[model samples]
Target: MNDVPVAVAAMPSAEGTAVARAAAVVGGPPAVRCTGLARRFGRRWAFSRVDLEVAAGARLLIMGANGSGKTTLLKVISTLIPPSLGAVQIFGHDAGADPAAARARLHLLSHSAGLYEDLSGADNLLVLSRLLGRPLVDPVALLARVGLAPRPEPVRTYSAGMRKRLQLAALLLKDPPLTLLDEPFAALDPAGCGAVEALISGLSGTVIVASHQVGRAARLCDHALLMHEGAARWQGPAARAVEAYTALHGIDNADGGG
Candidate 1:
């Protein structure tokens, strides 16, 4: 089996670490705030009347079954789509009124890798950096940080795990303060999963992960939100959220271990 290379023990830079420490000490507005948030496609409500608040430097786990609106909630918070009702704020900036500001402060890793299939992995990062109006940082270093070697081959030939690694590199390049990850553990091997978990553990900014890998993800998070039928069923300690999820679903083992 060809496993993707992952720098499992990679550490953030001194500047990154300082920024995280400062944010924690300053104690400013919540990193993410949503009031009566809702989204709809025609007549079907993807999610409705959801209220959420995540403090700075907190890790939040969003758990739900398929079609439970986990992806939709992340999208709205990321400013990729507008909420049909209510409002969203990122770092105290109203997402609807100031989308650019909100977007500048957050990074969203969705189901799609969002890479240019025809471009090399390095080139993809460079292009994205340019498009986002960020400085031209070293793509090779970014790729290396994510345990992906610089390759001349276009992303079209890369494996699913490789693409995911490249996406991670992109996330590093942006280095946004608020990160929204949707199913980050999917399409990854044990090593890749471990690498992702490590990366999340090191993030100093606010993180919200939507995942089904309950056992591993919950432990890494300080808070958890459980979604059921397009609504938030529970929100509190990560362990209790896991218990509520398992009890509601009647599962003996949610993800094998907590």
Candidate 2:
């Protein structure tokens, strides 16, 4: 049997060094920029007065409790939902002004699997690849790369963890400059979790992840942004950011799972 790829290894120790190396290798403009970014639903705001910048090849983690706008912020950045106020730019393209171009540079993996229940995993990827006007990739091969054995069953028959792997395989079809992940580790099994950590560590571009798993995030990311009540409570290096988040939540650093 072939060995698992380094990108899919689930070891806790695999986080910092690999991600830091990727961050150090690249420079120049920020891959993602949000200025005074805010989002609202009717009379309520999802997130407001948010300013964020992620340098090329950097790994950034977004930490917050439920309803703290982690998901909302990611949606705005991915152009999936429009910001109620302020501006967003991806690779210098104004998200509001040229959403099409901006979106092309980003791949968002949100809570929803975004797959067809009745379709086989490979078929789902094929449809998306066609929609993007990109050449098709062998979905089975891609699934194997993510630590999943390729199967012919419909996506609806797969467990939550399996679905996540299918979604990730779809992502590997494109080489987007920025990847936005919301709660990537949720519902994953031990192996599944490791696969995600390894993939993030191996990515060559910028990444922004919103996860409540502070310890895992801190390990996988070099920078961190903490949000509370729809506002940025803290932002900076992962160590200090982890400290700030722990201080607010009154939790010990070790309790933030890896």
Candidate 3:
């Protein structure tokens, strides 16, 4: 066997160092970070003091009943609404100071379909993709992926579930690194629900899902944050977090009964 040259072996390769640095950045930084996050509408606080950190590729489920601030929190994280207090960092970009950069890395799907009612499903997605500077794609393919047939009629004529699927297809076309989904399973038939779940399971980026379907959402998520009355009750592994939320909800009901 030939002996390797000592000079060559001793030198540190620039490419190796660069790769290591990239890995360090990806592994070290949390994909989403919130500190002392609070949002209010008039005198009512939607959520308060919500400190959270989620790494890249994490599936985080926000569990709560109605009026629990799940939608509000997701809106704040997505930079759709400014926080009343504290800070949010998405992929290390400050949402308050650098909303454009943060938004570039995030996609939000609210309860509303957020589509142009007058436009056809394909047209709506095409318009958004162009506006967002995403690659122009065949809307029919995307619609098919979401289990919606290509139709010429306006989205105004679509059923609730069809509209929801159309919106999902549009966002999937954007394919941002961070996704915020508010009640993804709502307004879906059994087949539509299965399609959404499958899509979520296939995603490799970070996801924050706000849903009242605790059991189903918990199954899809690795981590969970349970909220009640605009406050987080527990944040941890999904199963335990669900248990904590159930126990806390029960306690609140018992107190009310008394």
Candidate 4:
């Protein structure tokens, strides 16, 4: 791990205690930390006074109904959107001010492919690889690594799971230390879900994933967050959260409490 290259992206929680802890104990900083994090649209509050921390090798699962500010929180942590209040730092770099630096080590995956549908898989990899200024890897090989065949069809023809695998390949190639995943299980078959979950588990980084599937969340995370109305109603072990959540709000029902 000593030879592992430093990340080029902005790290979101590499400062304060996290930095000291990471540097002293192992190889990198804690995965993420959000302190008093909030977002507001005029008088409306998307979220407020949120505080959380994740350690190296930690996986955090976030669960919430729609409009609960789940995506908002992820965006704020990933440097994609600025918080109306509070600060986010990665590896001691300011995510808002030094996004490029933070992004050097950060990987974020969402429903959007973030690929050029008009281009080949190789082309997509080459483009983003160049953009990130990392070592250029063979695109065909990358596709194969993700279990996609080297076909001539444009990325537009890829199935949802294939696209997800491609995006996952890109993240894997980067070997980033911090990853943010949003609803990665959508449209995936049971086998596909297992594949994705295994890939996530194998990634040697700190991961934060947002998903509605309590089963996957429980398997992939050391802890889980129950977000409702833009705040965390409960935060603790993934299994405990699942049990508590089931008790508080059954699989058939939807509300916030346990």
Compare the candidates by lDDT and give the number of the best one. 1
Residue lDDT tens for model 4, 8-53: 1222322111121122225555566666788988899887777776
What is the lDDT, from 0 to 100, of the residue 244 in candidate 3?
72
- Give the count of colliding residue pairs in each prediction: 0, 2, 0, 16
Query: Which should have the higher lDDT, number 2 or number 3?
Result: 2
Give all candidate RMSDs, comma-separated.
8.6, 8.1, 12.1, 8.4
Candidate 2 weakest lDDT stretch, 10 residues = 3-12
* Native-to-model Cα distance after best TM-score fit, residue 98 in candidate 3, in Å: 1.0
Compare the candidates by TM-score and give the number of the best one: 2
- Winner of 3 and 4 under lDDT: 3
Candidate 2 lDDT tens digits, 144-238:
88777767888889999988888787777776888898998999877778888888777767778898888776777767778888878776677
The segments of candidate 2 whose C-alpha lies over 4 angstroms from its true place after superposition are 1-15, 19-28, 253-256
Candidate 3 per-residue lDDT, tens place, 1-258, comes to 221111001112221211111111344557788888889999999988788877766667788888999999999999999999989999899998999999999899998888999999999988998898886658888888888999999999999889888878877888888889999888777777877777776665677888887766666666778888988877766656556766877743311111
**How do all the candidates rank in terms of lDDT, highest first?**
1, 2, 3, 4
Clashing pairs in 3: none
Q: Give the TM-score of candidate 4.
A: 0.83
Whole-model Cα lDDT of every candidate shown, in order: 0.79, 0.78, 0.76, 0.72
Candidate 1 or 2, higher TM-score?
2
- Shift of residue 221 alpha carbon in model 3, Å: 0.5
lDDT, candidate 1, at 235: 72
lDDT of 1 by residue, 1-258 (tens): 221111111122211322232134255778888888889999999988788877777777888888889999999999999999989999899998889899999999989988899999999998999988887668888888788989999999999889888888888878899889998888888888888877776665778899877777776666778887888877766657668788878985568433
Q: Which stretches of candidate 4 lie over 4 Å from their true place?
A: 1-29, 252-258
